[model samples]
Target: MNKAKILVVEDDRAIRNLITTTLETQDYQYHTAAKGSEALLEAVSFQPDVMLLDLGLPDMDGVSIIEKVRSWSALPIIVVSARSEDRDKIDALDAGADDYLTKPFSVDELLARLRVALRRARQDAGPAGSPEAVFTNGELTIDYAAGCTYLAGSEIHLTPIEYKLLCLLAKNVGKVLTHNYILRQVWGSALPGDTPSLRVFMATLRKKIEPVPAQPKYIQTHVGVGYRMLRIPEGGPAAPLGE
Candidate 1:
């Protein structure tokens, strides 16, 4: 049974009930709050492993809550909102949300995203030490110490930029990296044409690592938002891209 603790912050009683019911069926521990103030208090008091937040909170905007929580915690926050616009997604993502789910979503999809966030949270909670020396995802292995990446046991040469991009995505496997976040981390700042440049580099990087770039097993794009590195199971079908 799943043991992840979740904090549900939504003003709509029906929607809140739907989410809590889903969590209950999975045997996930959860606490609910109807207002942003109560949500923050529960966030601190409950210390949940993840948060399912609605952007349109009656007390305050969910983005503000995200910012407040980010100040003291690295807790995973997934925005579940009726706002489906690209701008809304970018705003929440940029404000530090780990993932965004538009309303009218499937239970399966919601559970999938929660699993991804839990994986990332567990990774972040690893023993305190010098950071992880290497990253492995399926056939891909990144040796940070040696500054080299290998695919299927063969060293794959990558441009400096491509290598950095790969490292960033690998380090953040399962968490959606917004375009602005990617640009800032890889390019050090957002400049004109940086987004296009990032896409080109990502495509080249995929060609080297993915067995079938057309149907990628590792990188999942979020259209206008950004990309996420999928942790695929051996011999299992890859999750759908463009989520």
Candidate 2:
């Protein structure tokens, strides 16, 4: 099997060298970038399976890099930053980092996280043909093959994250998915304080898909548990809202 390629983005020379050495020792191929601009270029050229990013890049904030990359790709990003504050970690996760590691992390922990990220990435990969080629419930429709959503026969624009969240819930229709599970599946890793972020995304998604956001017919919340997608029956109306 081919070794997994990793792109390490850190401005500090010592830390960068250490990570590269560890990568080499682990028999992984890697490329290095000292700044965010270089990191983006390397990310494209190298097409790494995963990325180790530093939030304190000299050229740009690592959060910005995560956002930019997430806009176009689902590349797994494991943020390794010196910022240990919960707020900082949540910020990175919210910005789309798959995992977070504070500086002074153990090599073992880092490798374990990388393995988890890779495994999740592989599990989340879509099938050869579109697995969810098309999903429809009344006016709302999702065409996975075309990467588009439509409501009332008109195409609706959704941000990348919103689209992803919608697709996840849609794919598992009629089953209640806990908030933590949704966060981990959608945002990569679920942090303790990430519930509010999930709520915000869910609310935005509801507004787009539900005819009545307050009394949503499709997406239903399980009050203190999680959310569920009501599997609309063919040629029939959605079920009652309360779950």
Give candidate 1's root-mean-square deviation (CA, Å).
1.4
- TM-score quality measure for candidate 1: 0.95
TM-score of each: 0.95, 0.56
Which pairs, if any, clash in model 2?
A: none
User: lDDT per residue, candidate 1, 116-183, as tens digits?
Assistant: 88978888778893458988888889999999999979999999998998889888888888899999
lDDT for each of the candidates?
0.89, 0.82
In terms of lDDT, the poorest run of 10 residues in model 1 is: 234-243
lDDT (Cα, tens digit) per residue for candidate 2, span 1-243: 438999999999999998998888889999999999999999899999999999998789999999999999999998899997766766676676766778887777687667656655664575763455788877789999899999989999999999999999877655456677798899899899999989998999989888889988889886665777875656877644332
How does residue 140 of candidate 2 score in lDDT?
A: 83
Task: Tell how far residue 87 is off in model 2, in angstroms.
Answer: 1.0
Error of 2 at 241 (Å): 37
